[model samples]
Target: MSNPKGKTYIVEHLDPELGQWSELEYVAIAKETQVAQGTFLLSSLPEAFNVPPALSQVPAFKPERRGVEELYANDKSRVCLLDPSASSDLGPDDGDKFDAFLFGGILGDDPPRDRTSELRKKGFEGRRLGPKQMTTDTAVRVTRMVVEDKIPLDEISYLDFPELKFNDHESTQMPFRYVKGQDGKPMMPEGMIQLIEKDADKSIDDLF
Candidate 1:
């Protein structure tokens, strides 16, 4: 039972805007990840943007206006990027070796537009969770399962493209892979199902 307080987890926000989905994921990340020394930092922000008050507890930096190079400056070699296209799997032993883990703050597209390549192109050591795309929070939790809990990637189970049954006629299919909980259910963040239903209803409204 080791706490992941020793490592710093950063979400490099590349999304055009922070929406409810990203917000829910970040809330989960803030609750689960115990970063080292300071709070969770969402970097590469725009000058005009403000992190909602709910996430005010976490640090959001506009690197253009406020330099944030210090995050990985202390030791860049110890940092790893969770890239889906990476060559190797993130191992359990990697937890003690790395000080910082970087995750992309973009929505996982159904076909995967490779948005992480924005940071991947920057040349940080890259590691993969698997071949499939996972939601940002799922990626973070899976990374913690390896790094913090010392679990191997293959030992973990997953559910892919699970459809959320909003009602008898309305259901939404998630396009990302998710870690299967012991209950044999996709381990989704709180408020996700409701969000799915809301989005599903909105889509229906758009059809009218």
Candidate 2:
């Protein structure tokens, strides 16, 4: 597909365990083209973009409680987008309006969750977590980006994922960038870019 009109913002959820490096999940395409020029539902982009639903929501193979755990533990993180024409819910001529890409990542145990209190008490406000903790932060960041039209770094609190023994003494911060596509191009909307850059600069100044 042709690139969208705005700057691309790539958001990744890195899993330190399983040797899975950073995976590109969500790509917010530019908003100027005829295909992306509307208030589309977050659920509608798979068809227009010729991508897959798996691109948005990764499926679980097992039905039991640990099915989720087993899936991720196996390191099968790829998702497939099915043909919309085959769905009874969608018509063949439907243009893939919301087929814009969406993605994320999962953090493995590293810095250790139990040590979070130590970090927080030591003036480390953002660091450490369980799966729920990390997911919550991710959801909040994505929502803020969509609603406020900008990415707020401060909104993201850090959690101690496991770190290498040699790098144990290093400090980790939550790093963020505009979402990008598989082609290494940004998929951010035009208006979103201005807001992200503006808010990011403000956040940096506040830190000082």
Give the number of the best model, judged by lDDT. 1
lDDT score, candidate 2: 0.26
TM match of model 1 to true structure: 0.83
- The TM-score between candidate 2 and the true structure equals 0.18
lDDT (0-100) at residue 189 of candidate 2? 32
Q: Estimate every model's Cα lDDT from 0 to 1.
A: 0.71, 0.26
TM-scores of all candidate predictions against the true structure: 0.83, 0.18
Q: How would you encode candidate 2's per-residue C-alpha lDDT over 170-192 as one tens digit per residue?
A: 32232333233345443323343
Top model by TM-score, which number?
A: 1
Tens digit per residue, CA lDDT, model 1, 102-163: 88656365566676777777668889998778888788888888987789998889999888
